[model samples]
Target: MLVGNRVILVTGAARGIGQATAVFLAASGAQVIIHGRSEESMDETVRLIQSAEGLEPLRVAYDVRDEAGMKLAFKQIKKIFGRLDGLVNNAGIMTEGLMGMVKTTHIQEMLDVNVTSVILHMQLSSRLMLKNKQGSIVNVSSIIGTRGSEGSAAYAASKAAVIGATLSASKEWAGKGVRVNAVAPGFIETDLTAHYMENKKEKLLETIKMNRFGHVEEVASVISFLLSDMSSYITGQVIGVDGGMVI
Candidate 1:
């Protein structure tokens, strides 16, 4: 419910679910650290948060795939905020391709950005959280990771890896007061998913029990809940934000 005064970091906060989550968390009173590939990309997100009269957010720009950049970003957070209370691993890339036809470059990029970076960030963030003996982390996954889709084999593999990491990390740090969980969204209407919405809207709708694609705010709300005390007892679980698509 409330994350007031908590210091949180949201990666890929320039757009889509990441942007929405950063805005929502800022509005809810968290001191949000907005991260993007470049400071210019975060302008709109920063503007929206400021317009809401939320706390002034800290801005960090770095490629999630770059280890040195990520380390520097964390160091900046530590120097500025003194402690990290929450982390949302919302930065990821999804490149769709069928198994045999998928480009090797696409697969590697997905693994590096979606899976590798997530684990590294988790590692860095958990250390900061452990010092405080309490913290929360939320990773953005997708339904495709759980139930494979036709043209997303490699993408699915990357997200599936996230789910696995969340489970393992939760167990590793739960006793030390760090909680890790993931949100597996279905058909969310974000820029990343615009292609599917444009090409297969009706067909995708038929599969979801709710008969609708989700909105960015819908997923953001769940991420906020996971970061707050409302989900204090929840960890190591992959909460589906899908419209009953998997069922």
Candidate 2:
């Protein structure tokens, strides 16, 4: 799918699926704005896009949980790009813990980073998009959010909340020319899932219908499609990039 020079912002673009998405979108011709916790963290992503001969991407760094930083980042987008055409809410943290042993602090942190920040970014993005009367939003949720997992209760909860927001926001914005959707990815081979892969690779492989973990580019391609006109008539849906793990 072609993004055709659309200005898009990808959060947590320093690594993993987020980084891959930024690179993929740039390759697809989208003018990407890559965000990370710090500018240094996004170096590799920047290099990858540049190496691919993609347009120079705007780099913005700030913790997703920082409200002021988030607002300022959007402001920068407006000042530089004049308008935002798409957003990928991919910045999030995964904290694994079982029921009773899970730390309250950890749960709260997940909520702030995964759920709250997503909502806020959508709000900010929609405002800019609405100004032009068009935009698309793609949220990166997790399969654990839809099907649940043994030790990822908090992370699941936060991701599930993202699904909820995606649905609600889609309904609220679709009539105004903006669309919102989510992708629930199953175990993906990324730094984020390295621990799980190391400890439960065999069992997880047996559970996956494809008998393998997903690749970052696989998820990135889906995110790009969602942000492009190829998915023009789609919204409020959570597409599973799970290799049939959810089924």
Candidate 3:
């Protein structure tokens, strides 16, 4: 395994892509720390990873936007793992609204969770990674961010900011051994998107080249690669895991 013995922390891992990434990384032999807002939800993620890989992930519960709590998380991570090797900034929220009708608070909420939190997580995690001189950060963006969606202005803007942050962060750490990248996933089948997918099935399928909602594991595969040595020379890249949805 390319990441054996490495310590990787994945935020927003209670379910969906975050959960899948945590499980996949554990299966790939990396020691994973699952972060989310609830201990119960994180426990379920740990249980799933244990069932699939026979290895349980360490759990860290905190709102990614909570700076003080996150500082404590990093301390705890260092206390337990000694070093941070990888960080997956997968925590975000999706809000839907026409740009003209979107409420101010709704847009702010989207930006806070999807963009601000990612920057804070990357900043704090990279500080720890700098000591080790090598690390990788993978942010989760969306196809809407790249192609613009009609009723998803806030969500698109937030995700677009993720791409911007990823680019600047990569340049900041370019020759310092810390790599930053992002995965812009298309319509993925998960509890959070299940309702929307079901409601817009016919319309959604028409836009996807693959004609199917992506599985969490499929997106997880790309995230796992970015966090591993297999992508050693890759940085400042946004790999779309949307089955060519944007194409």
Candidate 3, 1-247: lDDT as tens digits: 4887789999999999999989888888889999989789788888888887735688888887788888999999999878899999998888788868999999988888889889999988888898879999999998988888889888989999999999999999979999999998988998768768455777888889888889999989999899999999999999988876853
The alpha-carbon RMSD values of the candidates against the true structure, listed in the order shown, are 1.0, 1.0, 1.3
Per-residue lDDT of model 2, residues 12-55, tens digit only:
99999999999999988889999999989999999999988889
Clashing pairs in 2: none
Give the alpha carbon lDDT tens digit for every residue of 28-60 in model 1: 999999999999999999999998788999999
Q: Which scores better on TM-score, 2 or 3?
A: 2
Error of 2 at 88 (Å): 0.2
Once model 1 is optimally superposed onto the true structure by TM-score, how far is the C-alpha of residue 5 displaced, in angstroms? 0.5
- Between prediction 2 and prediction 3, the one with superior lDDT is 2
Give the TM-score comparing model 1 with the true structure, all chains together: 0.98
